[model samples]
Target: MNIHQLDINHLKSLETPFYHYDMELLANTLDAAKKAADKRGFHLHYALKANFNDRILELIQSKGYGADCVSGNEVQKSIDMGFPASQITFAGVGKSDKEIILALEQQIFAFNVESIQELLIIDELAGKLGVKANISLRINPNVDAHTHHYITTGLDENKFGVPNSELEKAASVLRSCEHVNLLGLHFHVGSQITDMNVFKSLCVKVNEWKNWFEERGTTIKVLNVGGGLGVDYQQPDENPMPDFEAYFDVFDKFLERNPNQEVHFELGRALVAQSGTLVSQVLYTKSGIKKNFLILDAGMTELMRPALYQAYHKIEKLGSSNQEELLNYDVVGPICESSDCFGKEVTLPISERGDLIAIRTAGAYGEVMASRYNLRDEIRYVYG
Candidate 1:
């Protein structure tokens, strides 16, 4: 089913704001990404931080995708939803000691270690449990992914990974840790990266590190090039597939791999962003001397991307006929915060009160980030 059939007519009857997911579209996207990865024998792990709704997780698990979790709860959630523990890779910069112990109890496939301290912590916890915790050191290659500074993680300034200067020291510490088994290396440049050249640069960095590890008589078995593939928010239809072929092709070409080495990816947004839409109704339209405002019932409370990332989502009226009349409107929400505006100078068909507004490409960082700020009503959902 499409957006037109997602109970938009009865949307107002249920609630003022909620997220609607196109399951068919999401499945197709998963299939597309999975097929691309499978062609090159690359493993695809769905980044649960993107969208962890139980229904979404179930479908993704059904498609044979592993779970890339950042917390203990996410690992439990994935396991509860039928994802295999052997397929789960726990990753985070600040995992708590309790979280580490929980993962050790579950025997997760690997922990993406961000720092040497974290590696020692994991070793201590694993020693307590009398089990070797498999781990992959997250390396900061200092490659500029050319994305937003806030989202760019591989740079030297970011606190997400261990810098190149610390790699040998981290490796030395890992070798001395008796309870931790060094699995391989992992690198994540940033999120919403649209440029293929950034990934090509990342591949070059991965190759250099792989050789570095091999030179030390340590073979890197798993090379996890973390996912930051950007989706086309401007033109969803024209580039819906998200260039997975090109993304996997880069690794297939530039990444030097051993016969037994397995390449893995942790994809989040590109798999689910276009498959969902946050459908809301325009409560009022007020024109002022300075600007016209479309007051939406769904604020950043429902979809926080606009407020948090200053991100853009194409907004369209569901049944409006005045498509040709262009007008500038600051799409505002009922949230009391001044920063709750979705977009400034957003061009939409002349909208009116009670007209449905569909926020396109909200499937990824949309509803999962919703909150009850301003004592707002509970958000709902309609799956197609």
Candidate 2:
């Protein structure tokens, strides 16, 4: 029910149901992240799966951040947008042969292999190309992220990384492969993680895993503690960016590393979520059987988080003065599905037809997940 104040006069002139990005806010977020990571000597690999907009990718690359890709095209996109192959890392659970071959052809920095078979496949493919492929073992630390179940990835139940029981097999394959170099270990617990203790638990597991590999006579070069730090979605304006300093401090305090080891983080949501908002116009305010429904042209097709995750995004009634009395209403989109509702019993100022509505904290999973369901027209993007 809390919404950030906006430039209503300027917003009214733009078309409705479009994603509005605050470039200034984005620049500030990037600067804060860079300063925090630099001070602690931690390398950042901006996760391209979060938002793959060409402008966003180029902007992040310009800031000297590395690329974290999950697919073959993403690998090429990062390189095409100016990210060097040495600074790019590819990760996924089910990578195809084509994707693996493409990554080998590009000579990417490292591949986060999830299984021993994946390691063998990469070894075979690299041997065919007569090139040594760099790889990092994606070990599942089995640490609970303490976040949503749908976003959790590091648990033993998840279909993500290799388990502890398979370490010997992984080591055997690594020793057998002649064209693969086991550079280090990688672990990603989950997304939208707010608790720092989850990372502390992960540090303990990573230390143990690193020691396991080192004891086997393998050098652990890179400790890739993947990123899942959550942002303040309920109060986006109050906390425009997540506390990156505190996040890095956790690793600095708990994670034990060798003198020659390097640290890396793959962040996505915390860097871009607050700088973008979904803008839509109210179409009608009608009384339903028991509650009032405020319908808008934008639906799940444009912003699917509310429908998919039952997520809450702060809603603001633009052009309405603060002095106006507030009322509770169910904000619904034009989609025919019953789950197309954004929020129920949302308190907003008295809204009328053509009133602009700002859906805050939609920068991460909002526009990227837009769909063509119901054959809806594609949305547009606006920059502030």
lDDT of each: 0.89, 0.90
Model 1's lDDT to the true fold? Answer: 0.89
For TM-score, the strongest prediction is 1
Residue range 137-228, candidate 1, lDDT tens digits: 99998888887787889998899988889888998997899999888899999999988899889999999999998999997889999999
Superposed on all Cα atoms, the candidates' RMSDs to the truth, in angstroms, are: 1.3, 1.9
lDDT top scorer: 2
How big is the positional error of residue 3 in model 1, measured in Å on the Cα after superposition?
A: 1.2
By summed lDDT, the worst window of 10 consecutive residues in model 1 runs over 5-14
Residue 130 deviation, candidate 1, in Å?
Answer: 0.8
